[model samples]
Target chain A: MPEGTFCNRTPIQSEKALKRLLEDTGGKTYYQEMKALEVDRDLLWGTIQKTLKSRLRTWLGICAHCGMCADSCFLYRISKRDPRQVPAYKIQSTLGEIVRRKGNVDNAFMHMAMETAWAKCTCCNRCGLYCPHGIDMGVMFGYLRGLLYQQGFVPWELKIGAGMHRVYRAQMDVTDKDFVETFEWMVEEYEEDYPGLTVPVDKQEADILYTVNAREVKHYPEDLAEAAILFHLAGEDWTVPSSGWEQTSLAMFAGDWEACKLQVQSVYGAMERLKPKRMVGTECGHAHRATVVEGPYWAGRPDGRPPVRSIHYVEWLAEALRTGKLRIDPEKRIRVPVTIQDSCNYIRNHGLKEITREIISHIVAPGYFREMSPNREHNYCCGGGGGFNGIGLYRPQRNQALITKRDQLLATGAEMVIAPCHNCWDAIRDLVEEFHVPIKWSFLKPLLIKMVQVPEHLRPENS
Target chain B: MYEFLAGPMFILSLCVFFVGLLVRAIWYVRGLHWQMDRVAYGMYPGPGIKGAARSIGYWLLPFGTYGWRAQPFMTVAFFLLHLGAVLIPLFLLGHTLVLKAATGIALPAMPARIADFLSWAAVIGIAMLALRRIALPEVRILTSAYDYFILLVTAAPFITGLVARYHAGDYAFWLSLHMFFGEVLLILAPFTKLSHIILFFMSRAQIGMDYGIKRGGINGKGMAW
Candidate 1:
């Protein structure tokens, strides 16, 4: 209620422990370790000075406080229109205040900023489209997260996520060896069905150097099999790099800039080593964003691109369908009422809206595909972007935020929601779980594999 | 006091207004690290410029963007405030006469009645915006004493100009106050949030090019949404 203070409705279950964690900064847990870490005023201010570049300074200086961004944000809309959820207010109160104070902030302020950055905003970049001045709170929040990460104020999951990238070069504990073995094992399971199906590993000069999200490698090895199946049937020269195969960057989500650079560089390094004509990442929005869109910048590539051309899985799917490499079986196409969950990282931020539509046209039967209102770039986030889905501290807010997407889904009258991106798929799954919605969700790879018209030569002998 | 305000003070404020904006623009450009910032400015000039133009053009129109369309009343007030702030001062007969007399440059002027109407509209617009800042919870939460101060300072010139034109108060007193506040507004323009008049274009262009070049906003993609 007071000036310069956030509403901070994110409930802390253990107040005493939180207090102790804040005071001592000395627990073995990631959250406690981050909480207990000492505030480095000098480093904080130094980073602030370094990051106070043209974009940020102009955005901060030019904001008219018109509150247009309030309605643009799903968090603001779904939280009963909470003032604190307003994108302009959220960024201004946190990053705006930090810069105003020259980063001479206390531990409490840092924690408050951490909450606002990770919880209130999802870095969806939706609000950027609506701002009259084009002040992107998403980009600013990302920069703020970098500052927060430097000061050890990141959330437990993201901190761990970043550490995983540092330790394993992947978001999970899975190593390069595990990834290669998992792909081999998963492909072998499907080998009998599609004989001679193999996941080409570390194959140099392959036309398409395929990469994947660690989630597919860990929880959903079947996704790897599906990708391999599709590529095999399409007769494309694709190989998965043993190293840098994990495309999603939790480091990017964590606002760990150094880790972000490191994570993306590994992928770039693989691209350089493999000499693949083009790289296609698995169905993950942020992975594409991390590796292709922002990674080049982070890795300091002069052309602002990776070593080889990188494309999203949707692009590859669309291209394959368009080029007659992969044909959808009309009999097997989706006939039930279905809609799409457009991943903001790609659809909005990267302008891959129509590419997904191309894929949808092929896979969905006539009259089966229903479009969500405000689809494509105008579509809302899955309420679990920017590492919101994984953080334990903000689960309530994250779940509450799903109301926007839920209402969108319900209005479409779709029994199934095809979420091409992994984050959207997971968020939709969580949304159905939390809200008990009847709609089922899926990634495109599995759906495509089922619906694709297998060539006579590529098809299993018995089938 | 009248002579100083009308002559030397006005000149001084004008110099500060232009030089201040120029210096601020230079500082902003200089602050940009070429590697970090400029690399994302979009590789293709054609698409980047197109995106930038579209971005600025859309926001200039009343209810042009999704944000504006959502808040109809605020959009009306915003346009009224900006149109009056830009148009009335530049095209008013009295201001043109003053300009012609001072700089020996004659300029076309709008009708007196239209100028009066715009001044009234501007005042009402400012009042509406100020009311929203106080009334709307979302806007109010972001507002501070500094925001209020900015509003008051911005409104002073229009209010005093209206009073002086209509002979509603002491003519000399109101006229002097109008000129003084107008100069103050000019002096404050580049240094405060008022700099948005110029920087708005820059911010929009940066984001536009960011999407246009880096993302697929160009080549007939991402233009619709």
Candidate 2:
């Protein structure tokens, strides 16, 4: 493996800059919230009382304190086994400390608790698989985040993203007109390659309602083009709603359940108005988890029933291949050795490991695919999940936490690493630059375009 | 006094254990809401019941979870200890003999030699766990005095029984002491972290149903422990 193939240009925000951003956001900051918690201890206790339920209590009680989960934590692994960074320690300090103090901790205690709950652990849920008790520490951290959120201690970027989602129905604050313009622009660019490619915006009664990460519009419009190419090639009836297209929710990451609810509700509202038979998300893992898994829980269905069936783009592509709707040109199959980096949301949280591989296998030739040691559900998080990447305040610590993951990627000895999740892509991209790992990163969409072909008659120009 | 401790106090401790467990169970369940996270389409790839069974059954074996796999020696030690502690109490010949005499109901007991070996294994397991708590920095930080207290309470009956059965102490005196410790452990079971004896299955099942059945595409293998 080579070093520093990509330049390490990611800005490390200074503490003062972060504080200034927080002040500009204009609300009670975490310090103020902690002071408030110190004065009215009952408020903190009341929140804990409402939130602490059976599963969490069971997790707290059942943990044998065996320290077996410590080695499983990437942060603990990379940080030279610092006891404070252990997954068990994360729970013990935040939830356990709260319970021990009965919610009457001081401002310093709250500050330490916030650091442990937010910056130390990514809420990746990798530790759950390692737990003999099957305790989902990710969910526990979420509940912890909720308490911290009440104290106005959420990470600044997450706070801003959630605020954007609540106010503008987009995490990046891309308005409806901006979104439509991006789609039109991308469609125009895509038509050069696949003539007559149309990026449908707010197409009513479409079979599939496609959602995207806000980053797709703001940073990587070419990803949208790839998705457009795949959908167009597959001959699938899909539409991207002008509103509710931004799929990823930093609100969920920040523990702002209200903003999270607004994001989900907006998606569902768009779906209801469009009446799509089903919903599909782009190759973004957390977005899929939010829209399909946690969204309904936070934002209820309109009729109080299940929301429209939600599927990941990988699943959609694999199904298309299975049914012969799409074909991969074996000649185009990636001949070089390639490995996959499973996003925590998709692998550990959703169990899409095989499907992820299957999608890659179609694009990559047999025996060319390499599995990372401890791949799939056991894969290490990219240290980007759970809103960790969104918070610029923890940038240095976040990069430090990626050491184990950097080692894992290098160990694979693959030239290209396929990361389906946007967050994973961003994290791996940074880690590759910082650690100077030689692996080139590619997402599933571009790979599918490279390796798969749409039949001539299905092409708009041919028709 | 022997009769009072063995017969009346034993029964009283059993009552406290059962009643306390029942109360806690009710409290746990009553707090639950119907709204839950759901499976995305094609997430669960297998049957729900089988996945749930696999989930609960997997953790019952040594090296079942990823954590246990990482620490093989400790996993085996804990497995052996759990096997002995759980099995011998229910199936030891002496225990069944006494229960049959008292209640006119009995479960078939293991051979005497097997029962004796398990009892010893349980004691050794408890000792190993205690040593680990004392020696390991990670475990030491989390280990409270209450944790050690609970360990003693749990191990006392097994040790005293071994003493009585092997005539290491006066048989009658050791038997009475054994009965006393047994009663105390019973009374403490529901009120202490020992409640995991009952709660483990529920937590595993809840995890299985949520991750295994719902999110793991019906088979819940995605999040299997």
Candidate 3:
């Protein structure tokens, strides 16, 4: 998320894209269009202003600003505990600027405010649990970000995300054939680790629908390999579809609510066809968090929402451990101290945090977890999820989030940081390098396999 | 020349102040394009009769089923401030009240007895709130000079009325002068930060029921608490 041709490409790219869309759309008014989306503008919205007042006033009255929110903000932790970098201040001051200007402001002011709003926060809501006064900054910013996106004010990388979502139907430009090919590749790679492994495509009546964060197919292919390896070793009947395989949803974070609806529809449509007894959301935190819970909720479920069972990777893996089907080798790991990062989305309403510990304890000793200072339910973001890592405009904000993570890693004195999700791994890895912090990042499953104490008698053929 | 300028200037200020504020509120209401879906991230289920009914409550009762409705103390404060505001205006010599009720008996100590006590008590109200505005971090962050001025203008008529009543000698003339300014405060009350007096109930009622009921829910992200 740092130092690309972002600045150079953004100006022309944004200008051209905005002009192109507005030109094609026939003079759309952004605000008017947003208020009454998917409807004709000629229909008079009599209560439109009344709706705006309640929303704006609620937004205005929402924040209690106790600074507990500072704990969850990635920027504060990454910036070595600078208070200004905390998420609460970002909301307070940005909204304060809007109020001070009486909502009539220039683009420069908006640019800075939007950066703070969109990038500085991961929309994780870890802090939301701790709040004595429940103000949802994630929702506030999400709504505003959606409005901004309509105005062509989204981050640089996310333009591509929106495009991918629009055309290719994935977070990245992942296609149906590419998805199938990757699964075929993963099956071969996984066999070296766990023999007789098979990842099926469009398999009817599978017991589980396992969704991988799209990052697995693109950059973090080892995760897919690890997932396949683990699932095979555990002897679970899971299928990764050629269609509904990619699950890391940037749309949830990009504030593209419509896009989010479309995604859930696509994923669920595939689910209805496969008829999996349960859906296993992968190690990606926000993806799982957004998909099963928020996505279905947002879509209105107008005629009653689908009731697919949703479980976290940790919970599923922990269940796998109980079955005694999965085992790992501890000697392959770095053998230094390590701690698990509890992804906010998976932990809160889903309670995957404890299960993550259950996972680490199943493989490594309890003492290996040095903990992330303000850890567990109160964990700071890794400056990644909620589309921040995918957004170029959020580089500095994401960099700020990296500050606390760097400090935390330095304090842990651990050799490795086990982040369960790909985006978290990416953010942690970037910050670890960017801040010159001496720590390596690993997905929990890979590290878990590394440290699972693979007996010398049952070593892999390569070993 | 002096009389022409003085009378016209005073009239112009009153007219501009009152009309400008009303215009602003009207413009905001018209421009905001507000609705139930807009609030709480479109969280309100907007339960038909139940939803509308839940938003309104007995003004005198605390814990009335409403989002921003007044509690007993706040309601008392509301009545005192508003009653004192309207009643003070009624007693002004320019109003038809004095001419009809008094006819000649010198205006009943220029604002009677009960109205006078609340006037003095209002200073305490203003002070308590001003202290609150200064002390609380949330309130303090949102404070402005206009807020202070509005407080002052609000307390002004009461202070001047009290002073004019007890001061004697030219007290009647001073009372008349107090009445004139008191009327001015009323003229501007609905527009300025004073509007919060009327607005606080609406805000509290909707916000209350929004968070309170499960059936009528609000959608949106949980805030960065």
Candidate 4:
């Protein structure tokens, strides 16, 4: 309610002011620009009226004001049971109030709602499991974010993320050319170690069309090389599309629905063009959720499926190990006490809980694998889903949210943590970094590459 | 006055309850677009039905779900209040006699003593729920004036009926008050948050099907948690 700057930082007051801010987009950072952007009441109301459908309406209507959802949320628990952190209270106060008032809310109200939507909840969908009424406040928060985005009330990083997808069709500025070239370069770097390893690009009618997170291309291209080595060792026909290679959708986190459609369509278009029997995405949680679980609905696929049969990297890995195509060297298997971070996006939302376990059984030595209490679908989010990790404005809250996960990991007395998804990996990394927890974390690929048995023929001559 | 309260007023309340709920259901369904909403439910009918059944079935039992198990006191209070609200009306001898008088039909009735016990149990349950709304910070924040009003409206019949049964006050006054509050509850059920009575099933089914069909929960795949 402070008057100087809306939400204490943004000076936006009217639609015209928002328009002027939009025109000058380059003078300051995206966050600074966002702070100056004004509320667009008509657009917000129009979106609410258009998108507030029966699922949300019934959900909003039937919430019994039960605080049972309080414990289901890690934030509420971690924040010392702050009433505002309660999942039901968070959604009810923000989205519920917006709907109750029919979008007649002001900038301060929108900003508060934005904070709750981004910082308070991770859209992990765990509360949906706990609610007797099945209210799914996480889903409602996602819907609320769409309304906030329409009013330009999103966080600076997410706004920039949405723009990246809009302009480059990737989360970061990694172009289609950059993704393919990076994959080829990474494969070349590993070719000396694993003889005859090749990066397949846009191979038509391949059994699997491999996709990857843009972060892998921009920052950790070794993920691509490891994927190639595994697929090559498995002797499976796999191809990565030259374009549409980026699998993660920050637009989803931004709640920019159009950009979500655009990003997923790029991946779906790759599937249509190459016509792979199935598509296997890299080890990223929300990427799978964005492109596989929720992507079909965004793309308006009738059967609620991607163009090709899409599976997570864990699914592919589990299958490869089960079929004896990829064998784990028993001596090389991880001997240290290790635990798994069950990513909510896939494990809970997509039902891939056991598949990850299947991969773990092969990679970890017997009796070395430890399970986090309240694991799998009921597991706490890694405190970084729904774009929480990237937003500087909510960094402190995001860091605090990790306590639930930090304790869950520490309880296992594990030295290493196997986090299969990129979001979980980043979060667990940040958690260890922030809390100085002794546990080390790695993606399945890094550990798998180390332990996977190299076929005699594929091995380099000197080795 | 007894005849009028038991006959015309009771019928009117039932009519409003049924017709209002029907309208609400229609309005809810009308808001859903087939392509946008229905398609997201996925195409696996077997898993969808199984998920829906499991979700609703588990929730109906005492200590059935993880959420219920987390809060022991609230679970006990909730089930007690809901069971009395449902069973007392259907099986109590006096209510059955009224129904028989109106429709020439008979329903199996519970012993008068047992019905009396249930009424008290329900009253206690209501008090417990009301106490949490006031005492628990998390629950209190979400509670509004309307929530307390709804709780009062919901508890009115059982409390008044108990008073009438014990003859603790003027018998005719308590009986008439019980009948009047019961009628008010029926009329308000569909319009107020009490709509959760019916909508809970629909909401639970939607989420179950969503998880089942789209997420492989129907095939018993990832539901380990």
Q: What lDDT score belongs to each candidate, Candidate 1 first? A: 0.83, 0.75, 0.57, 0.85
Candidate 1 lDDT over residue span A1-463, tens digit each:
1111111211122434334333422223445444445667788889777767987888887888888788899999998898988899999888988888887888688889999999999999888888888888998998888888777677766766776777678888788999999999999999988988999999999999999999888899999999999999999999999898888898888887777888888998899999999999999999998998888888887677789988998999999999999999889999999999889998887888888888889999999999998888899999999999888788898999888999999999999999988888878999899889999899988898788888898778888
What is the CAPRI rating of model 2's predicted complex? medium
Q: Which candidate is the best by lDDT?
A: 4
Q: Please provide the root mean square deviation of candidate 3 (C-alpha atoms, Å).
A: 11.2
Clashing pairs in 1: A25-A36
C-alpha root-mean-square deviation, each candidate: 5.2, 6.2, 11.2, 3.7
In model 2, where do residues sit more than 4 Å from their true spots? A1-40, A301-306, A458-463, B36-51, B219-222
Judged by DockQ cut-offs, is candidate 1 incorrect, acceptable, medium or high?
Answer: medium
Clashing pairs in 4: none
Q: Residue A303 CA error for candidate 1 (Å)?
A: 1.9
The per-residue C-alpha lDDT of model 3 at residue B138 equals 36
Sort all candidates by lDDT, best to worst.
4, 1, 2, 3
Interface RMSD of structure candidate 4 (Å): 2.3
Candidate 4 residue runs with Cα over 4 Å from true position: A1-36, B34-39, B222-225
Candidate 4 has an lDDT of: 0.85
lDDT by residue for model 3 over A141-213, one digit each (tens)? 6655654554445565554565455555677767778877887887786676665667777888788888877
Each prediction's interface RMSD? 2.1, 3.7, 9.4, 2.3
Task: Chain B TM-score per candidate, please.
Answer: 0.93, 0.87, 0.55, 0.92
Q: DockQ for model 4?
A: 0.63
Per-residue alpha-carbon lDDT of candidate 2 for residues A1-463, written as tens digits (9 for 90 to 100)? 1111111111112334334444644333433343443323687789777777777877887787777777788888888777776688789878888887888877677667777877887888878777777787878888888777666555657656666777677777578888889878988986866876888888889988988888888888888888888888888898988887877888788777877888888888888889888888898988988777678777754222226777888888888888877898888888888989888886777778778777776788888888898888888888877877766667788888778778888788899998888889989998988988988998888777877776886556545
- Give the number of the best model, judged by DockQ: 4
The fraction of reference A/B contacts recovered in model 1 reads 0.64
| Over 4 Å off, model 1 | A1-28, A33-35, B34-39, B223-225
Worst 10 residues of 1 chain A by lDDT: A2-11
